[model samples]
Target: MSASTTLWTDRPLLGFDTETTGTNVAADRIVTVALVHSVGPGRENETVATWLIDPEMDIPEPAQRVHGISTEHARAHGMKAAEALDEVAEMIADALRQDIPLVAFNISFDLAILENELTRLGLPTLTQRLGHDIAPVLDGLVLDRGVDRYRKGKRTLTDVLAHYGLEQDGRLHTADVDVSATLDVLRALTAKFPTLGTSSLEDLHREQMGWHRRWAEGMNEWLTKKGKTPDVNTVWPL
Candidate 1:
């Protein structure tokens, strides 16, 4: 990225992602989580912290196929879910305390599940730890929606990375790898969209909130027309 861009990404960006047991924010558990800290592009000055957690439940076959983390593997080598989640929650809250944005693909899903998991384990949620709603979140999915409202295809992590010229690398579903890819996509997105790169972090975060709402409404409309249930939540981040 150019040195001239006054992007939030120009500062220390902490990219976060999680591979879970399932898609339900309330019912699912996180099997693996990754937090990637990058001080610059090209992966220079980066630190990655990852954890494999024993979700304490059977991983459904579909989830196993998506992330390749079977119950057997996790049970054999993973940290207890509550223990790992406690540390993860602390790290995230600590980062946000310093005004660092929590970067994720579709932050709501992960953050929501994380919140739920924290509560499930009798631990403080991120918001409780921070004493406020998490701020300065940089969601790649929301940013992509904001920048390209009419794009026709999927906006998965790999999809957006490819759209923005970042390679797929066949590691999209892995936690740490997905975190790295997501940060790269953000850098690319900023370089291509000047308005996004130039906005203050708070402004960008607020914009994403609105953009996500519109996208959700549009998606629900499309789903309704197709005789399908409209289940997209408009919440910015949990």
Candidate 2:
């Protein structure tokens, strides 16, 4: 467990993401998991660990369109959602306790979803084990929105990859592939914005939290103007 004081390039970061039955993190059951741990820096990088769990819930076709995991495929080979959820939650907490940061595209959503699942199962949520609000989280999405406030196109993982001139090695929907692509996005963003590159991971986390709130507010207002519900701002621990 490295402390948050560790240098931006020195800290170990565990990047997490989950594929679920749907987009409502609070209500959804996780169907797939992916984590990529990077230790050390640049050319000396050590990237390891990847897991794909069978989320026992019937993965809906609409959800499958996002991540390509079908109910039939998941049911045929997916691990029990409860079991996978436990392992995922514990691994994330262990990483955080050890001082390793967690990076997710939209960390708030994933962390909140995982917290809900853990609580339902009588396990400790990441916030509980961490004894603090979820900080030290690096969100590529938030960083991108902050750095390029008016980027022209979609801000999705794939869209951002193309925007940065980076190529994703694996298919988009798979967890590990998305994680790796996300890491690439972060590296590229930091490279382009030297200010972000030099900031310690802790500072990056602080900055991202502010950015997330602002972006969420703006997005919500835009949704209201269009006569739709602003759904992304739900209470995190729900």
Candidate 3:
């Protein structure tokens, strides 16, 4: 909440993730969503909850190749996209309003795409719901890129997981499994960089903003070196 309050112990955090039809955050629909909430004290150690939403869009072959969610599987098992989007937006807004941190891999992507989806559905954008831009946010991908710029390979979730020697119990693309894996990544990064976990939530938020920008710059440089132009808009979580 404050610039001086530690987040890991001061308040709970909501780790979220969404799989989508594609990388167009503004246009692509969320195919699935997951939220893993950690609440209460360390002694109590209660995991609040996790939610899975079936995005109704056809899970394209390319997308399925990454997250492993097939169109038929989602259609048979998923909730309506509009309904699930509303619930996810509301839950995220609640977390922000309550000063709980929202942890995601690439927060800008998830937050931006979520904002677009909410607007398209005539629901409240995250800023409208929280009365400001989201804060007290933690991004494992951003941190990993910032702290491990010279790791010399793909910085994808799987790559980063391997870099940190963390493994997911299940495959990626499924909401709950990915969210849990992302949560593990988040913990690993913070543990590896003690300054991050020790900093106050507000300071950490500001620090991450700078970290993301630096990572973007570094990634762009690396891409240029390989004669490949980086996606300037690929900021986070698509």
Candidate 4:
């Protein structure tokens, strides 16, 4: 679809997510990754790709409890981290080149971890592949907070899904399932805020960067008030 004639929802969206060994984007490894490409507003066309990766490190118990993939299982059944990461990066780069939004919940974590993994593996990062920083990303978490700023309580993927009156069939924390849920949540958000649906993907992406920056600044301020060090990054796609 032409950008001038199509709304964000009318165009294709590539949903992405990762089940990692831990929450440290700088050091953690990806245990699993998923990418779902949805076309048309009704989602009549979709292509889903997923990979289980041997992170080459022990999967801590707490992390395993969240995603339910043990180190033994991954080592036995997963692809090499370098190979899997290369494929994931290439897929994402292809999507961005096609002007498709990469939909993810709390995308900063995924992108950050992926970049770190690529760098560690001596592979070209997304920026290098795309010739610039990744853009035109649609973050479900950022959009939810931007449009519904006053809403209280948690804003995790599950929380946002419930807030939008949607449900996931499979358990969360799985890469594929989480990607599907994230796409659904984005659709729900668009339904609730029709204006968002009407904007161009690039516009929506730029808007999200602003939204995320504002949110991070506010969080840092709150943390400072509580006498805690503010560690949040105000940058987008970090």
Q: How do all models score by TM-score?
A: 0.94, 0.86, 0.82, 0.96
Best by lDDT: 4
Model 2 TM: 0.86
Q: Mark the regions of model 1 whose C-alpha exceeds 4 Å error after superposition.
A: 1-6
Per-residue lDDT tens digits of candidate 1, residues 22-104?
Answer: 99999999999999988878666779999999999999999999999999999999999889999999999999999888999
Each candidate's root-mean-square deviation in Å?
2.1, 3.3, 3.6, 1.6
Question: Candidate 3 residues 131-217, lDDT tens each?
Answer: 876887888777787777677778778888898998677777676666677777877877788777777777777777777777777
> What local lDDT score does residue 167 receive in model 1, on the 0 to 100 scale?
83
- 188 Cα displacement, candidate 4 (Å): 0.8
Model 2, 112-148: lDDT tens digits are 7788888877887777877877666788888999899
Error of 1 at 206 (Å): 0.4
lDDT of each: 0.89, 0.75, 0.74, 0.90
RMSD of 1: 2.1
For residues 1-238, write the lDDT of model 4, one tens digit per residue.
5668777776788999999999998889999999989886433566889999999999999999999999999999999999999999999999899888899999999999999999999999999999987988999999999999989999988888888888787899988889888889888888889899988787888899999999999999999999999989999866
Sorted on lDDT, best first, the list reads 4, 1, 2, 3
> How do these models rank on TM-score, best leading?
4, 1, 2, 3
Q: lDDT score, residue 204, model 1?
A: 90
Better of 1 and 3 by lDDT: 1
